[model samples]
Structure formats: C-alpha cells, structure tokens
Target: MKVVVDTNKCQDHGQCVFAAPDVFRLDEAGRLAYVSGPDESLRADVEDAADVCPLQAITLED
Candidate 1:
C-alpha cells in the first residue's frame, strides 16, 4: 500500500503518529515524516491514522 499526506493540509498535530507510529512520525525539526510505501501489514494502522487525522491529510492508495 502507498500512503500520502497533504502537507498543505496537515498541521503537524501528530495524530497520525499516534495512530500509526510505524508509518508516521515527527522529524528532528518537529515536522511530520512518514513512510510513503509502508508494508502491507500496516495498511490497517494507516487507515486508522487517516481516519483520526483532523486535517484530513492522510491518503491511502493501493
């Protein structure tokens, strides 16, 4: 699965990180960093991350 987060829409609130730590995280500068192509086993967590993203920035593409 492929994941994409719209940086323009994201506020760096870290909701995605809490939902899917394996795929999303904060960088040294406190910016959002993520795995664009995470393992398929992480799809569910990614989906949950997308759901919890208040800014609606997370997108999942198969």
Candidate 2:
C-alpha cells in the first residue's frame, strides 16, 4: 500500500504516530515523519491513522 500525508495540512500533532507507530513517527525536530510504502500487514493501522488525523492529512493509495 502507498501512504501519503499532506504535510502542508498536517500540524505535527503526532496523532498518526499514536495510531500507527510502526508507520508514523516524529523526527528529531518533532515534525511528522512516515513511511510512504509500508508493509501490507500494517494496512489496518494505516487506515486507522488516516481516520484519526484531525487535519485529515493522511491518505492511502493502493
């Protein structure tokens, strides 16, 4: 699966990190960082991250 997060829309609140730590995280500067192509086994968690993003910045492309 392909995961995309609109960084312009993201506020770096780390909600995606909480929802899917394996695919999302905060960098040393505390900005949002993520895996653009995560394993399929993490699809559900990725979807959850998309759902929980208050800014609605996360998107999934298959």
Candidate 3:
C-alpha cells in the first residue's frame, strides 16, 4: 500500500497520527511526517486515517 498526504491541505492537526501512528506522525518540529509506502498489513489503519482526516489530505494507492 502507498500513502500520500497533501501537505497543503493538511493542517498538522494530528488526526492521521491518531488513526495510524505507525504510518503518520508529528516530527520534532511538530510538522506532519509519514511513511509513503507502508506495509500492506497496515492498509486498514491507513484507510481509517484517510477517512478521519478532516482536510482529506490522505490518499491511498495500491
């Protein structure tokens, strides 16, 4: 699975972080950081993250 977060649309609100901590996180600078290519096992969690993103910044690709 592949994940992409649109930084321009993201507000650094950490919604994705809560939904999928393994794939999304806040860096030391408090900026949004994420794994572009996450394990397939984490697809469900990543999808949940994308669903919960208020800005709809998360996109998933097979």
Candidate 4:
C-alpha cells in the first residue's frame, strides 16, 4: 500500500499516529511524519489512520 498525506491540509494533529504508529508518527518537532510505502499487512491500520485524519489529508493507493 501507498500512503500519501497533503501536508498543506494537515494540521499537525496526531490521530493518525494513534491509529497507525507503524506507518504514521509525530516528529520531534511535533509535526506529522509517515511512511509512504508500508507492507500490505499494515493496510488496515493505514486506512484507519486516513479515516481519523480530521483534515482528510491522508490518501491510500494500492
């Protein structure tokens, strides 16, 4: 799976971090960071993260 986030739309919120720590995280600067390509096993978690993003900045691709 491929994960994409629109930084412009993101608000440095950490919901994605809680939903999928393996693929999403908050940097030391408290900014959002994530893996673009994660293992397929993490699809569900990534999807959940995408769903929780308030700004809908997260996108998934097969």
Candidate 5:
C-alpha cells in the first residue's frame, strides 16, 4: 500500500505516529514524516493512522 500525507494540511500532529509507529513519525524539527510505501501487512495500521489524523491529511492508495 502507499501512504500520502498532505503537508499543507498537516500540523505536526503525532496521532499517526502513535497509530502506526512503523510507518509514521516526527522528525527532529517536530514535523510529520512517513514512509510513502509500506508493506501490505501494515495496511490496517496505516488505515487507523489515517482515521486518527485530526487534520485528515493521510491518504492511502494501492
């Protein structure tokens, strides 16, 4: 699966990090960072992360 986060809408919120630590995180500058393509096994977690994002900046694609 592919993960996309819209930086313009993201506000450095770490919800995605908690929901999917293996795929998303905060950089040293406290900005949002993530793996664009993660293993298929992680789809559920990635979906949860997208659901929890307060700004709804996360997108998933096959």
Candidate 6:
C-alpha cells in the first residue's frame, strides 16, 4: 500500500501519528512526516490513521 498526505491541508495535528506511529510521525519542527510506502501488513493501521486524521489529509493507494 502507498500512503499520501496532502501537505496543504495538514496542520501537524499528529492524529495520524497516534493512530499509526510506525508510518506517521512529527519531525523535530513538529511538522507531519510519514512513510510513503509501508508494508502491506500495516494496511489496517494505515487505514486507521487515515480515519483519525482530523484534516482528512491522508490517502491510501494500491
């Protein structure tokens, strides 16, 4: 699976980080950062992250 985040819409809320720490995180500057392509086994967690993102900035693609 592939992860995509719209930087324009993101506000560094870090909800995705709480939902999927292995795939999303806050950089030293408190900005959003993530793995663009994560293992398939992490699909569920990624989905949850997308769901929890307050800004709806997370997208997933095959």
lDDT of each: 0.96, 0.95, 0.93, 0.93, 0.95, 0.94
RMSD (Cα, Å) of candidate 4?
0.6
lDDT of 6 at 7: 92
Summing lDDT over every window of 10 consecutive residues in candidate 4, give the lowest-scoring window: 25-34
Q: What lDDT tens digits, residue by residue, belong to model 4 across residues 1-62? A: 78999989999899999999999989899998788999999999999999999999999988
Per-candidate clash tally: 0, 0, 0, 0, 0, 0
Q: For model 6, how does the per-residue alpha-carbon lDDT over 1-62 read when each residue is reduced to its tens digit?
A: 99999999999999999999999999999998899999999999999999999999999999
> Which digits, one per residue and each the tens of the lDDT, describe model 5 over residues 1-62?
88989988999889999999999999999988889999999999999999999999999999
Q: Report lDDT (Cα) of residue 43, candidate 1.
A: 90
Q: What is the C-alpha RMSD of each candidate to the true structure, in Å?
A: 0.6, 0.6, 0.7, 0.6, 0.6, 0.6
Model 1: pairs clashing at backbone N, Cα or C within 3 Å: none
Q: Which stretches of candidate 3 lie over 4 Å from their true place?
A: none
Candidate 5 overall Cα lDDT vs. reference?
Answer: 0.95
Model 4 pairs in collision: none
Backbone clash total, candidate 4: 0
Residue 10 in model 2: lDDT: 97
* Candidate 6: segments with Cα more than 4 A from true spot: none
Candidate 6 or 2, higher TM-score: 6
Error of 5 at 29 (Å): 1.0
TM-score of each: 0.95, 0.95, 0.94, 0.96, 0.96, 0.96
Better of 2 and 3 by lDDT: 2
